[model samples]
Target: MLLKSIHHSLDELICLLDQVSDHDYTKSCEALSNATIGEHTRYILEMFKCLENGYDSGILNYDYREGNNQIQTETEFAKQCIVEIKMGLKSENKTLYLEKVINGLGIRIQSSYYRELLYNLENGMHHQALIKIAILQFENMAVNEI
Candidate 1:
């Protein structure tokens, strides 16, 4: 069921991407402090990617995203990333460790695959809201319902 919600969100995101022109998709938005829509989409995808990469290792580290510039500069590449993320979401739930740096110290907390998926869902939604705000900053821009 959670996977269904995540897939639905990705579908909506893909639909939104289809409506965005290449120019608008990579245009830096003042509302986002000069961040592009593709950048936010990349961030959203990378979180899930971190989870997927860590599923086998049993350690998830969000601070270590590869920061692929292509994902931020190419809208089609970002869309392909979303599709790949959906494909990778079918793993069974398992015990996982979320490793993070807090106050200059690394910490690990027990987590599960499903729990991280939920976190990714909420994170994606939050970024989507920011993306909407950025789109509104464009002159004569129309945001389609997603």
Candidate 2:
């Protein structure tokens, strides 16, 4: 049931992403480019679910290893997400969209944090990444707002 909430929220997010018209996408991209942290914050929330809830409806983040002791990082992917968002839409008006996305992230994080505490923390791997992601998102939003 708990995982279902994450899945539900993920579904909502996916739907929102899907519903992004060409205009919205362009706006998102523009917003992302000019000191916007909303997209990154969202990607982290979804990616964390993918890591925590495997085989579930949640979209899981996966990385491939090219060679021995070589691991792919999400850095490129993160940058791409921003670029992609920018490509779709011209940047949004700072006074409104930023506030909305940031507010949405706060709600999503609260949902995920509880889900992790309920299902993930018990016999789970290091939760540091999740914490870091959340902190970064929070920090990014806060930093941009200033």
TM-score of each: 0.91, 0.28
* Candidate 2 runs further than 4 Å off: 26-38, 49-146
Per-residue lDDT, model 2, residue 70, is 10
Model 1 lDDT, residue 30, Cα:
85
In terms of TM-score, the best-performing candidate is 1
Highest lDDT scorer: 1
The 10-residue segment with the lowest total lDDT in model 1: 137-146
On a 0 to 100 scale, what is the lDDT of residue 40 in model 2? 37
Overall lDDT per candidate, in order of appearance? 0.87, 0.31
